[model samples]
Target: MSVRKQQLLKQHRRNKRIALLAIIMGLLLLGFIAPLWLLPLAVLLVWVVHEAWFADHLFYSPQDDYQYRFPDGVQPLSLRLVNGRLQLQESSLAQQATVIAKVQINSSWLGRWFDPSICIGNDQQTFERGAHGVRYLNLTGQVEALTTAGLAVQGRFCSIATQIQLYVFTQPSPTAGNMMILAPHADDAELAAFGLYSGANNVSIVTLTQGEVEAEYYQRLGLSQQHAAQLKGRLRAWDSMAIPLWGGVAQTHCVQLGYYCMQLPKMAKQPDVPFASQQSAEADIRTARRHNTIQLPGDATGLPTWQNLLADLAACLMHFKPDVLVMPHPEIDPHADHIATT
Candidate 1:
């Protein structure tokens, strides 16, 4: 045998010996320190760690006779292992191209490793160890007539066989449209629809309540009055700032209905629930009466508070006229306000 082949064989033998020694030591340690009930888990963990460590350094020769052909009328594609790194090459007329490739690495003991990666051009991609074996990567880049890409996979493992399939496609342009997000609280819209808000041409957020009940609840929890006030103010401020930032435009409308927090559904079900503090409730009644926003059938004294809420929401819907409406799922959501809003 050649000197290089001899060296590789010797190194592989040494790696096997080291791996065996590590597993024995781990078993002994677990037997002494780990409880009987945890022995199985400890053994499994030790075996996994040993296998991963072994795979990280092992190298396998690629089958020289293996040949890969590109799809009919598509760009020519080629893959080869060079100095422990996988190199992918493709010929294209476009200046930039998106390459999507699926790579399968098979190990005798440890199941198949599905590491799919995308490469635009000469970009380098890294693979990290995953639960099953290793997670793949995606690459993006710009190239001339010919594109060359290299992937450096961590933890060199001998693959029984490696299969790679490549596909090329263009990315679609961004779409524009009107989007409406309804939130039971100030921050809910940002939390749920930030992606839509950022991408859509026009976005409107309707926050149903001021969430003052949160401040009251915090106070009831023994927080200082000043701290509670600060928390409430911060929540409102973040809600306002987050929408503008996510929407990428100041033209977005933020409609605040200023309803009592934590009481909408309760008031709808039982109008006598007393949604606000006595002082605030009396003040709100006076304001509603003056604005003529509160119109109830029969006596005003017997009206349900959620009727006004529904009316205000209807008015908002009529004005915004959104093509898409994003709201909380009624049955799936556990929050009373979210369910009520839905």
Candidate 2:
């Protein structure tokens, strides 16, 4: 935030690749000109450059486990929801049992609302909202009498369940430790885990974007290009807010880096000349400024300059101080922002 820091940031942006390349080239030139006393130092300098910039780190530790696999002997369900209840792999339309979990209810019938109940044979458990994919709403009525016949599940309305797997609640796993999730785009975290973070005792979600996401559906609605882009970014920002609610995460725990994607290199090293012209696909500054909720840099106004996104991201890490981080695989993923998000 300081003026001096800002000036340094600009200088860093301007020389991201040039400084390293220049040093290496100079060292190589020196070695070629004189192969005696200065030659050894130049070769060492070149190796140092390679080691710092290109080579992989020598020290290593075992990677932490992020995904949770079901233990042996646990049955996972692929059920169909019809009328009011989940058919429990029934796959038929004959039954209309009770549905209690709030996630699958469709919630619209001319403003008619149904407070669905879960049947515990002798008594009924009443609930509203909550009970998403990973986070189960704990109810008192059905705590005791669970049997193979399965308690009846009823919903106010009907919705669909694509996949459902049940895991026994025990002490928290490694994932429950202090954790942080890094998302390159808006919904990437939810695409990976619906409510997994709800189980973690201490966790935070950090979404990185230049607000460059596209919402072509908005364009179809006849909005101008900039308007559509801003709307799309705000919609994703809304998504960031809603996800934490689903996982029982406090609203403050989620943060967005309102930093734009860096501009593409106008100058190349080995080539070092203006390359052939290409299409222009850039980060939407309009969209980034519109994104609400929690953002660290630029208040909410994002930029699209030629700077690395890491400085802002590093500030986020320092603030949260989480032990475990979930991020996109740099090599496996091909998106530039996705690669930088880690």
Question: Residue-pair clashes per candidate, as listed?
Answer: 3, 5
Predicted structure 1: lDDT: 0.54
Collision pairs in model 1: 56-155, 56-156, 118-139
Question: Which one is best on TM-score?
Answer: 1
Which candidate number has the best lDDT? Answer: 1
Per-residue C-alpha lDDT of model 1 across residues 34-89, encoded as one tens digit per residue: 78777888778867865654464233222112234435666524454455455555
Weakest lDDT window of 10 consecutive positions for candidate 2:
57-66
Worst window of 10 by summed lDDT in candidate 1: 285-294
Computed on alpha carbons, the lDDT of every model, listed in order, comes to 0.54, 0.50
The per-residue C-alpha lDDT of model 1 at residue 66 equals 24
Candidate 2: tens digits of C-alpha lDDT, residues 120-154: 34455443322222223232233233222444454
